[model samples]
Target chain A: MRYKVTIAYDGTDFAGFQMQPNERTVEGVLTKIVNKIAKNPGKRIQIFGSGRTDAGVHALGQVVHFDMNTQMNEDNMLHALNSMMPLDMSVKKVEIVSEDFHARFTTHGKRYMYRLSLGEFVDPFKRRYTGHWKFPIDIKLIKAAIKDLEGTHDFSSFVAAGSTVKSNVRTIYEASVRFDDATQEIVFEFYGNGFLYNMVRIMVAVLIEIGSKRRPVDDIPRLFQVLDRNEARGTAPASGLYLKKVYY
Target chain B: MRYKVTIAYDGTDFAGFQMQPNERTVEGVLTKIVNKIAKNPGKRIQIFGSGRTDAGVHALGQVVHFDMNTQMNEDNMLHALNSMMPLDMSVKKVEIVSEDFHARFTTHGKRYMYRLSLGEFVDPFKRRYTGHWKFPIDIKLIKAAIKDLEGTHDFSSFVAAGSTVKSNVRTIYEASVRFDDATQEIVFEFYGNGFLYNMVRIMVAVLIEIGSKRRPVDDIPRLFQVLDRNEARGTAPASGLYLKKVYY
Candidate 1:
């Protein structure tokens, strides 16, 4: 039977989700805990996640699925798995899913939130979670640039160089930028069918530069037509973005 | 003429705020950056901070002051100093105060905020920014425990051992907790005249235990009456709390 698992993790302490022989990964850690709890320490479980978040990136509704040989009891598995996981990562919920359910292949959509702290006062407490930009980012220009990102188009301009993807075309459902004056957080929330490697980060960099008036808003649409990586301005730092949701 | 300045830092990647030989510290990094700008190869700028936050701990208003003998505009100094500092640390404001603006001694009040992600969904993005507790925390229990903590009190029970403070009596202006449903972040903001070493951390540990109902809330008040350190629970993790403000 296939099992659906919901997880919570502190990515600061992890290298990423995929396993490396010498380094710690979210998938490796979860696999170890789940296998230990199942009393099959030798069992190698392959957990397929809805997305592959980069190192230092984080998620809330990160979904995954794996098949187990033993009889499935969702409540018992949830409790047992959670008890065995490390303090930084926990399996919050577990359920039995149909054989047809695939965490990655069946993912219908995804939502990501990019948090930027723009002001003189960069709260040290929020430094790890938000991107700190000291200069004034022109909101109107960023909003104008975001309009160019909406809808389906060839996204080769936003994809990072050396990516292995065969196709650069993807559909973006929504893209918007808004600032919270009280907290001084400029949050950009995006929903899309999928993203290429470092696509979101590059998009953010272009938008932020546009917001700073370093690049014109019209450059977004123009860059979409170019297939070269150096044609885009820059890639924003990875610290500001989060995998907020993965819908399936 | 020499001037004093204040600084704030996210100490996750720093050894500490104070400079140490051959180590990455807030002071060490600042000193390097400042010296680079002033072109003073042999100059030593002494940077003094209000308190030393441990590794992984954060400071929203970590006060620091230093003196330099170079002629640089305030805007230039701000730009140059920040250009050299790490992205996690920022100079909120620089003022040419009276030569007497001691970063530590002239402070009147201060505030710290301890954040806890108290629910199931732990956003990977916010992992470094908040402490996660999977169990349900009793808000009423935490409130009851903190009631005894308000006002002037000798907080030796909450202060970490080996701290060289002669007195633990400190006046608290405000002590409370708030919940953000949208983000599922539970924040504890405390405004106090000063704090003993690890005072906020120890208090958070006790409160967290109480909130989890692992210990009775009345135990907090009872433990305060005792003079021994073993009477309370564990110290809260350093990642959970932050220096929010320094009122000078």
Candidate 2:
């Protein structure tokens, strides 16, 4: 039986979503427990994730798929997984799906959100969750700059160096920024067909710079035309990013 | 000169507020930093807190007082202390106080808060910040039970066992419970002249039981009459408790 599961994690202690030799990872931890429940004889039961989130990047609706020969119910599987997993990660929902559903290849859209704290000093309780911004910012500038990111465009300037992808074209369906006055935090949300490695962080960095008047708000369009990674000056910290959802 | 400082700390990593031999404590950490800033030789410089909070309990407005011979400005002192202290703790405010000011002895009232999550399975991100309740709860019942706890009363039933305090009489100035729908968390706030050891946790436990129908809503009156620690039955976990403020 093929199963689809939605999970949420704090991601503070995780090396990343990808598996490495000895580092603790979301994929490694889930695979170990999935293999245990599968009871596969000397064979590894791999769990497929929608995409990879960098170290210290949280996830609220990360989807995964795995196969098992056991005839256990979905409820039983969810209960077992939540019981065995560490306190920082949890299985929010589980469903038996067709073998045709692939967690990664079948994905059609993705949503990512970033949070920033506007404070002179970092908050003790929020240090692990929110990225701190020390400089004053004009929200109108960020909002104006973000509007230029919508629609299809070649995001070559936003991609990190040493890229291997053949195409830099991606369609951003929506981009919005909201300021929460009570918490003194700003949240940026993006929904797109796909995003390249470090794309959201790079865009956030550029937006922050524009809001702070270090760069002109009109620079985003020129960077897209230049197709130079060096033109994009900053990358936001990983702690602020969250994989909000994956749509199939 | 006498210095009074207000600090906020994420107490998840500390053993407790009081100093213990070979233990990582909030007091010990603050004292070490204070002595370093004071530059006192041979004799140790101690920082006195308003009260001791149990291990894993958080603080948003904990106050402390200490003496130093240096004549540095308040801004420099605040910056130096925040820079030297661990990331889990930060100085919020600092001021040059009178010689007669004392953190503990001069305290007048306090405000404490407890957080509870009404989720079947604990939320991964909120695990460190909120207490989980597996059973169904009625906020109305808890509110009814809480009304009897207001006003001046002898709260002997709420004190923990092995307590050695001379008086159990305290004045409850106000109490409130607010449920945040977006976060699915309940926040309980209490303002009182003083609190005994584990008093807030014990009272919260009783209230939770009443809300969940394990006990009658009228149990508060009877428990006060009993005047026994055994009447409280349970104590909420330390993670959900927060020392919100210390009024002087």
Best by TM-score: 2
Q: Each candidate's root-mean-square deviation in Å?
A: 3.6, 1.9
Best lDDT among the predictions, by candidate number = 2
Clashing pairs in 2: none
lDDT of 1 by residue, B1-248 (tens): 44555677776778766677877888778777766776764656666777777777887777777777766666677767776767678787666656777887888988999988865545444556678787888887887778778888777777778889899788888889877786777788889999888888888888889999898878866776785677775887777778888888
- Model 2 stretches astray by more than 4 angstroms: A40-42, B40-42
- Least accurate stretch of 10 residues (summed lDDT) in model 2 chain B? B37-46
List fnat, each candidate: 0.37, 0.68
Using all chains and alpha carbons, the TM-scores for the candidates as numbered come to 0.84, 0.95
Per-residue lDDT for A76-162 in model 1, tens only?
A: 788777667665676767889999999999998888888898766556557657777878788888988897899998998888877
Q: Residue A204 in model 2: shift from native, Å?
A: 0.7
Interface RMSD, every prediction, one decimal place: 4.3, 0.8
How well does candidate 2 score on lDDT at residue B17?
92
Give per-residue lDDT, candidate 1, residue A36: 69
